[model samples]
Target: MPAARESLLDAAYAALMRRPWSAVRMVDVAVSAGVSRQTLYNEFGSKDGLARALVRREADGYLAGVERALGSAAGPRDRLTATAEWTAGAARENVLVRAMLTGCWTERLPAPPLAPVPSCTAVPAQRRADGPLPTPRDFVRMVRDRAVTVLAGPGASPADTAELLRTCELVVRLALSCVAAPPGEGGMAELVRAVLPRHLV
Candidate 1:
């Protein structure tokens, strides 16, 4: 992208973090970015469109982190442990993520006359001008696939490895939903202990 476009995105992101999305006006983003409203519209279409772009940017950041976590030389268990720690840590520290948890800007977006509960799950990767929690399936898939590749190492059959990965996905999803505590050293170890035994056999 052009330098101006990049500046606009950065400014928009900064604005979104400081206040609720409803409070963000396109003009404000333009002013902060040192661009005109017309330029903002040309690049981002509309506020809703800008929201989607923001979501995509954040998602890219997250996927990159996942890849980095998996790329380390650690064993499958350690890799997975580190991935979980980073994920939860990111979620906790991310301003946008905190907005979702605190319900800070729930009504900023246009809603349908009759709509489902405003769970973060409904936000499309491209449609989300706002960042929400990672989907359970997505979170599970990343963890499971990386675990399979690293843990299986050499000589493991692909079929068995796939089975292990799928099993791990299910276990991880349940742990994410049901486990009360945040994932940490002990929590991550417990999650691995629960899934590893079943998949190892």
Candidate 2:
């Protein structure tokens, strides 16, 4: 089901690049994916549904990159630094990621098809209970939560968890700031280092 949904999303994304989101028809997406229109509708429910899924998938990819950065580094500080660098670099290169980080959509790229609504109001009860769907803001929070856990390590006390949460929140905000307006050269890493305690490093 995921693969099929991805195929549909890839088709929609391709269509979006060629023209405006308003112009990209569901029929065109279905044809591009070699699936029926009903199948597309069944998978996503509507154009808005498809758009949300696409954004979620993109967020998932970005988070996966962060996870990889975390694994590659030697320690907590190094991991946070590497992830920040990676986030800034990736956001610079990818328009979708840039939009997610900065909430600024490009003229060429499709804006999220859904209307603005509070997260709690927009998401269904079942989905909210199961896990909140990955909106861009939710993605940031998700990464922060994961980072807190990683920084805390195993058998963490409440104090350690609280401290790690604060550290991760700071790191994520700094990383996002870099994404919004890049600090050239080694500036991002330096900023991250400045904020972190020596003991954490």
Candidate 3:
């Protein structure tokens, strides 16, 4: 079922890339995945449900990239730079990610509710998908909190926690700004490094 679920999502994404979301048929997605329409419905419940799951998957992937960037072996500032780079890169590469970060859902994309939708499904993945989706502000806060957690690791002084959080927010917001209006030749990494202080927690 997990494999089928992924295959369906892949097909749905491919279809979405080719046409507007409103025109993307559930049957087409199921056929592209080589699965029955009933299987698709059983898995996602409805087209809107599928949209939520796909959007949720994109958000998860972007956050996973953020974690990887944050966990890099580089210095604290470098790691923050990496995280910022990841944020900008993810937004640029994936329209769904860009929409999630910028809160700009074009007519071609599905705009699922940021608030949680009621869930009656027994499927674990769909249930989680039906949970509250992160808004753009939530993404900023999420990235900031993750950066603070990674940098101020394990019994670090509480005194600098406030400063650290502020710095993290700056880094996250700067990255988002770059997504909207890309920086000049300096690129995201240099811009991130320049903006982040020499002392990163």
Identify the candidate with maximal lDDT. Answer: 3
What are the RMSDs of all candidates, in order? 6.6, 4.6, 1.5
Q: Which stretches of candidate 3 lie over 4 Å from their true place?
A: none
Q: Which stretches in model 2 have alpha-carbon errors above 4 Å?
A: 105-132, 135-137
Give the poorly placed runs of model 1, Cα more than 4 Å off. 95-105, 108-136, 146-155, 170-180, 183-186, 198-201
**Candidate 2 local lDDT, 54-169, one digit each (tens):** 66666677889989888887888788988888888888877777787777877766565333423332334213222333455766788888887677778988987887778887
Candidate 2: Cα lDDT at 88:
83
What's model 2's TM-score?
0.77
Superposed by TM-score, candidate 1 places the C-alpha of residue 106 at a distance from the truth, in angstroms, of 3.7
Count backbone overlaps in model 2.
0
Clashes of 3: 0
Per-prediction TM-score, please? 0.68, 0.77, 0.95
Give the candidate number with the greatest TM-score.
3
Clashing pairs in model 2, backbone N/Cα/C closer than 3 A: none
| Location of the lowest summed lDDT over 10 successive residues in candidate 1 | 110-119
Model 3: per-residue Cα lDDT at residue 7? 100
**lDDT of candidates 1 onward, in order:** 0.60, 0.75, 0.91
